[model samples]
Target: MRVGRGAREDRADARDIEWPPSARSPGPAGRAGAARALAAAGASRHRARDFAWPGAHGAEAGVSGCGRRNILLVIFDSLGEGALASMADALPVLSGLRREALRFAAAYAPSPEGGPARASLFTGLDIPVHGVWTDGVALPERETTVAQRLAACGWRTWLVGRRHLAGVSNWTTEHARPFEYAHLDWAHGPLHRSRQNAYLAWLQDRAPAAYAEIFPTQANADDTDCPDWQRAAMSALPDALSFNRWVGARSCELLASHGRDGPFFGIAGFVIGETMGAAPRQSSPCEALQERALRQADAALGDILRQLERSGLAETTALVVTAARGSVAEADTDAPMQESAIRVPLMIRSPGLAAGTVAQAVSTIDVAATLYALSRVPPPRRLQGAPLLATGPGSVGRGWALSRLRRDHGWKTALRHGRWKLVVSHGDPDAGVQPGFSLFDLREDPEESRDLAADQAHQGMLETMIDLMIDARVAMEDRTEPRIASF
Candidate 1:
C-alpha cells in the first residue's frame, strides 16, 4: 500500500547526502588502542574485587565484572525514564525486559540531545572532557571511541544504526557518524531505514526475491529499500517492515555471524519512543506513536534474544538497553538536561551481574567505561565515568550525574547530586555566573517545577552543586590530553 508521498528529491544526489546537511570531516583516526591494550594486560578476572563505585569525580570503580562477552547495545533514540511510569501502556515488552534485567533507576544522558549524549557514551567522558558539547560538531578523531578499543582487543565491532558516528550531517543521518568499523563493508549510514545497510544488503543478496516481496509495495519499488528511502520515522512504519524490526533482523544476523566463540560489540540505534522526550517535534503525540515504536523495538529485541539463545550466546553477551535520556518531555519545551532526561532508563543483563535496580545516578558517559571493563580492556586514564555492574553490595551510585547543553559557542552544565540538581549556563566567561542558572530538589519535584536555587534552606546544597560543576569542568578541561573513547 502507498503509505505517503515519496519525498521529492533527485536520486542522483541521494547517495552523497550526509547528516547535519553540511557536516565536514575532521581528523579521523582512533588512538592506537593504548588504554585498551593496557587494560588487557592488567585485567585478570571478569568480576570486580569489591564495591568500588566511582565518587563525584569519575574515580576508579575498580573494574567491572565479566570478560570477553559480546556486547549488544540498543539505543532507543530519546525514549526516557517516563517509559517506566504506569502511564506507559505502550511499552509492555520493554517493561518486561526491565523486570528481568539489572536496572539503573537514575541513569542520565549527559547532554540535551543525541549528538552530544552519544558522544559521551562512545567516549566514556563528559561534555567538557570529550569536547563534543553539541550535535553537528564531530568528535575529534584523536579521541578513541569504545568501538575502536573493543575492536583492537580482537572483538568484532559492528555498528548497526543511524546517527553521527563519523560526521555525516544530512537530515536523515543527523546522528550518523564516520564509518569506523574495523572490518565491515556495509558499515555506512543510510538516508532512512536507519543505520545497518550492511546487514540489509546482506539480506537482499541472500534472498533477493524474498526481500523484494517482504512488503507488498516492493513489487513496483525502484529503490528496493523503500522504507529506508522514504525517511519515515521508525515509529511511523508498519510492524513487518519497521526500522525496529530491522534492528532485530540485523542483530540476529550479527549474532549468527559471530557464533558462540567470538567476541563482538554491536550498537543498534533506532528512532522510537525516546526521540519524543528530547524533541517532540522530531516526533509527535508521544504516547501513541512511542507505544507503537516500543512494540516494534521490543519485537526486534525478542528476535535478538532468541537468536542469542539459539546460538548459546545469550549468557556470553553483555546486553545494554538504554536511551539517550529519560524524558525531555515538557508541555512547552523538549530539553534532555531536564530531570526526566537526566534520569533515563539503564538496564544491564550480563553474565556477571544479577538482576536488580541500581539506585545510583549514572550518566551515558559511563557506558564506554563499563564496556571496556566488561571486555577486560584497560579504559583510558582520561575516562571520567565509572563502571556500574562491577561493584559489590552496599555500593552507592556516583555522588553526582552530569549534564550539559550548548546554547552557542559557550554552554551550561547541570549537576545532579542526590535529590538536588543545579543547571548553570554560560555566565561571564571569567566569572561564569552571569546569573544563568536554576536549581531544583528532584526528590520532591522530579518535573522541576519548583526552583530551590534561591531558597535559604537549600543554600548549602546549591553551593555544593556549584562547586561540583566548577571543579568538574576545571578537571575535565585541564586533563585534555587525548583520552580514548568511541561514538
Candidate 2:
C-alpha cells in the first residue's frame, strides 16, 4: 500500500480553522433535554460506541465472512456535472484516479432536490415508492432503507455528513437514526450560517484538534455563503470553511477506525449544492462558492483515499463517489425535470469493475440496489432501483432513464432513452403546451438548447418515450405488488 500524507491532511494547515463564538452559549437545559431524549432512545450510548470495525454487528457480519469488499459511498451535495468534469485539471488526485473510475456520462438524479434524491439512494426505490419527493417529506418508517437492509444482512452501515439524512421529518420514524453511527441533533450557527454544531460534534468525537481549529466558534445566517437569491434564511453556525473541513476530517477518522474483519458500508454525504439554495443561478455569487467548495471537496476526497490506502483497506474497498443533485438552475426556470436540474455526475470504482470506461445512463438509486446484490443482501420490498453493475456497459437496452419532479413550482417529467431525451411538464399538458415536450438528440445537441418536440419526424419517438416514462411511473407506484427481477 502507498503510505503518505493525504490531501486532506495537507489542507488542514491551509486555513485558520477555528470554532466561531456563539453569542448565547447553549445552556445546560438544552443539552440536558437532548441527553434525556437520546438516553431514552439509547442514542447517546449508541453514538459513543466505536465504529471502525467493519461489519461490527447485524447481518453484514454474516455476509462478509472475510470482509473482502468495503463500500465507500461518497456524495457531493448539489454538485454540477460540468463543474466536476472541468475540475480534472485543478484536482490532480481525482484526475489521476479517473482513469480507474467508471464515469456515467448520462447519470441522473431521481429527483431535483436532496431529500428526494437521497431517499431514492438509501431506499433503492424511486420517489414514487419512497414518497420522499421533497425536502421535508418524511420517509415512512415502515419502508426499509438500503442502509437498514445492509445492516440487517451484516454490513456495518455508517452515515456521516449533512443533516438532510436524519432531519426532523425522517428522524421521527424507524428510518430516523437508522445508521449505527450518525451525527445527529444539531442546529445552524448562532450569528451567521458559518458555524455548524453537528460538524463540531462529529469532529469532537473523532479529531478534536481539527474540530477546534475549524469551528473556533458558532455562527448564524450572515456567516453562511448562502446565495442572495436563497428563498430561505441562512442559519448561524460554523462558517463554510470550518464546517466543510470538520466534516472532512471527522469522516476520515471514522474510516480510519473501521475494523478490517468484514465488509463495510460507509456513506460520506455532504450538502454541497444545497448549502446555499435549492439551485443557484448561473451568474450567482454562490457560483464562486460552489467552485471553491468543489476544490476543497476534491482535496478532502484525496485525503480519504489516502487514509484508506494507509489502513490497507483500499484494495478491497469498493469506492463509489457521486453527487446528490445538480446545483445549477436556469433563470426563470423552475422546472425540476430540466437537464440542468435533474442531471448529476456518477462515478464508481471497484475491484471487479471495468476501469476507466464510462457507464451508460445510470441513476443514483442504482447504487443501493447494486450494493445489495454485491453483498448478497435482500433488498427492501419496495425498492425500485436495480443493480448497475449487472446492467453492464452499453446494456441500458431500455434506452432511456426516467426522472420525475413533484415539488415546488417544478412539476415535470423526462425520459432519456439513448441520445434522444424528451422533457414534458406535468402542468398544463393539454393546453397546447408549446415547450412542454422538448426532444433533444444528445449526440448532436448535448447542451439541450433547441426544442425538437414540434418536429413531425421525431413525434413517433417522443410518443414511444412518453409511454415508457408513464409505464415506469406506474410500475414504481405499484411497488407494493412484487415483480420478478429480469436478471
State which candidate has the highest TM-score: 2
Candidates in order have lDDT scores of 0.57, 0.56
In terms of lDDT, which candidate is strongest?
A: 1
Query: Given candidate 1, what's the lDDT at residue 197?
Result: 53
Please report, as a residue range, the 10-residue window in candidate 2 with the lowest summed lDDT. Answer: 14-23
Deviation in angstroms for 204 in model 2?
A: 10
Q: How many clashes (backbone N, Cα, C below 3 Å) per candidate? A: 35, 60
lDDT of 1 by residue, 120-210 (tens): 8888777766777666568877677887766655667776655454443322233323444643433222222223455346546655654
Tens digits of lDDT, candidate 2, 382-429: 555666665566442222467776623436777765556777775544
Model 1 stretches astray by more than 4 angstroms: 1-67, 86-89, 171-236, 273-289, 330-336, 390-393, 427-434, 478-487
- Locate the minimum summed-lDDT window of 10 residues in model 1: 17-26
Error of 2 at 118 (Å): 0.9
